[model samples]
Target: GSLEHTAVLALVLAMALTAAAPALCFAALAVAAGGLGTAVFCPGERRSGAAVFTAGCALGALAAPNLTGVLTLGLAAGAGLLGFLLCPEQALRAVFPPPATPVGTQSLTSAARKLSGVADTLSDIAETVNAVCSCQMPPRGESYDYVVEFCAQHLCQNCARRNTCWVQGYSTAMDGLYALRGALEHNGRVELEDLPGQLSTCVHPADLCATVSHGYRLWCSRRQTRARAELLRTALTEQYSAMATALAQMAARLGRAGLPDPRREARTTQLFASLGLEPLECTVLTDLAGRVTAAVTLPRTSFTPGECRALAEEMGRICRRDFDPPEVTNCRTVTMLHFGERPLYRAVFGLASRPAPPETVSGDACRQFCDSAGRAQMLLCDGMGTGKPAAVDGQMAAKLTAQLLQAGFAAESAARLVNVALGLKNAGQESGATLDLLTLDLYTGRAGLFKAGAAPSFLCRAGVVRTLDGASLPMGVLPTVTGRSTALTLDVGDTVMMVSDGALCDGSAWLCDQLTLSTRLGQSPQQTAEAVAASAVRRSGARQDDITVAIVRLERQKS
Candidate 1:
């Protein structure tokens, strides 16, 4: 069909050229047009069209008189029309196909730019908050001033000798009040004898002592409250700052990510068209690390499992990189499919947990999952003591940590933020949990262990067991807690085992032996975890604390 169109166009142009340049040979022009059309159209089907074009050229060259030439021209034109009508659909496609320009690239760049702007907004808010909080904080030596103000308001305001004690004898009254600081702080009260003679000679010495003592108590309570508030403010400030920095870095990385590959985009578009799927938008973003993420938006429709797999395979081929199956989401007007870079290695997790004696729920919580960044994370938290109360604390900590990590936060930031939340939950009561996290970068096999007052984790590699132990305070005990981080490399067949303190209460030797024996015997991670947890409970006899064991083993993904 395209060849026929080309012939019609070429012949009309030739006629125009002949009229414009009468000295030019008309037959030569026709021959050149045929060769040009052959080059422009597909090769296999060129024979019929080229021959018809050549006949026209030859007949024109004869310059025969009258009807003879006219008949020859009519025959040539009929032959060309026949060739055009017989052209294949495939050949037509070769002549005019999908454009190579990358679709949705501008939209992707705009999204990244918006993210950068959001980061800037967050930074501005954090800076503004930090400035406000800093200004509200009282100076270190102003506690005494608060005590004096309290005494003046609650005691001297009603005293008959108020002017004599405060205004006329201002210096004496101030000195007497300042001197009571040590007595109130150390002994919780001040005696009449503790006051200066000038103030002791007042009409109501006993009342003065009682009122001043009460004010001192109130001042101490106020100071404690302020201290807690200050700690909370500091933690929140740091969290906001950290969040802004992380978001900004992510935005910067994506904002300047390399241009989309035209070849890949064109091939992908063609494949979708072939599959009868009309995509509204399709974009492939490659980061500085060469990691690729593809997004395809289509009219809201469901996809069969096979169709999804087919799309993934076709996309992988187009990009020359393996892609995980697209995660599908349906918005109000469109369906979105997001494909992330698949990791080389996969992890299998196994967990075994049990409550302490006489309790139905365990005080330990564990989670195993993969983050959007392709990092496999396993979390274990041990609460303060065994019971439902402890279980609640442990579960809360683990849940919050998992959510933050999944949201793309750094491990340390998430832990610190959780710590601040727990520390401020109950004003006067103490509540805390130990955090033990194992993060594995599935793409690189690099592993990190982060611990906060939890038991040591054991790593079994090639029949040898290595201990990952660190001494750290539990969260909620302080204003902010920093988890201990240890990094190492892992590979296929290497297993990492984590447990609550109850598992290692009797010491780590038994668990180490169990892990090493299990590895040598080639037991599955689930079996090993169950075996270790049961043995630890048996060793505890009465089971004074909850027992939890989780193991993660790296394995090569089967293609």
Candidate 2:
């Protein structure tokens, strides 16, 4: 009796210990068993075994205490293990020997390949679905129902494997379409008329459905959004291309007529009209048969003899004329005069009268110097912000400064007047304007620079560059802001560049490089300015910003 009881207790203890083993040990054993089963069975048989195991476990767990009773009846498991151990070792070895042909491993390789392929397909589908969700298309009433149907049909066709992925994708797409339809229908009635456009715009419906099916089969799968963005980018590029083509054609058609002088009155009007720009107090001049000409007078600040010659050559090219002789014909004459107690620089050229005969300087000194100097006065004011308010403040400062300067007031006095005007306009808002006032005096070969909260003007001379800083606050904000005037003496080969902060900030280095290159190339002031402006624009890639520049050169007359 004692021996039997001892044997029973040992067996019960062993069974209980095995049943209560740590989760990891149980999991390992289960994995080993599964691997053995997989090795013995084909794919279909393995799947069947997996299904039976899942169903049995579910049923046993649901049966509660009955599972314990079934597990306690371990005689069958013990007998099976005993039989497995007692089986002939030679026969077992023969049954489990490595395959002679590597082709026998095709089952696993084929399954792995299919699994990877399905995973990739599912990933693509998920990306398509996500893209559709993110799409910002306008709602299309009952057209949304059609979209759902379209997606469902594609999903069914692509994911005919009847996997959970297909069902989930179909359901999700349908739900989305229903929501969209509801929103659209709430606003108005849905119609089949809108279905075509919706269908056309729906991207990769079939692929999305296929992905859903594949994802359902895989243990883990993730959904693709870059495709939609790429499509948008492509569309934008196409639109730009079309616009550029049309514009190029138009420009070519306009260029077919005879070249108009950029410097003569009628030509200036025609040129501006052709370019769709506003008319200014400028003229365009052309040579014989209107082939070559100057459209705009070179600003005194950017004028240079080389630029003049280049302009003339450009004109000659258009006119097919011979104006190059004048370049060599007039390179030795020099002239000098005095203005307001300062000796003025001068360069003479045969193209125009050889230096105006010295006459008594009359009229308002500032106004006469500005008007008769063959130079334009420009007052640039940057307000505190963008939009209407800033524009208004900036315009006020510019207007007042121009008015005072044109009325013969000195630069300092003009700046003071602008300051006063701004203060009156925006006394309480703390709004102000920064000023960059430049007076190009071609007659005196000087540029009067006045600034109030603006960067110093840049002067390029003899291949050296220097900045002239101004010490003053912007206008309007302060009750009274004093400004000082600085005179920039010009030479035949010197250039004075004045620009607003907007232009300078956009491409200061490129502007400097362009200036140096233009000077080296011996370009006229106008050419240098235009080239610099164009280069700056190109460097900025057409980032729109306010741009302004003023250039002046003096050319000696030939002996």
Q: In candidate 1, which residue pairs clash? A: none
TM-score of candidate 1 against the unseen true structure: 0.69
For each candidate in the order shown, give its overall lDDT on alpha carbons.
0.74, 0.45
Candidate 1 per-residue C-alpha lDDT over 116-169 given as tens digits, one digit per residue, 9 for 90 to 100: 344444454345435534644443312767778887887779888888878889
Q: In angstroms, give how far residue 120 of model 1 lies from its true place.
A: 17
Candidate 2 TM-score over all chains jointly: 0.33
In candidate 2, what are the lDDT values of residues 1-559, reduced to their tens digit?
A: 1223323543554456457864223323333343334344432232464544334333333433454534533333345446655777445433332212122321232223223333443344335334533443322211233444454555545554435334545454445445444434443433333233323333555464343333322211111123334433543454345334434543453344233332233332333334444332332223233333222321122336775465455434534453331211111231111011111343321100010112121100011123322454655566765455666676656655555454344566556545544554452457888877667654456667778887566777887767777787786565556566787767666666655554564546666767787778877766775665555445444344444455545544232
Worst 10 residues of 2 by lDDT: 348-357
The reply for model 2, stretches above 4 Å from the true place, is 1-369, 372-376, 440-447, 538-544, 555-559
Best by lDDT: 1
Query: What are the TM-scores, per candidate, against the unseen true structure?
Result: 0.69, 0.33
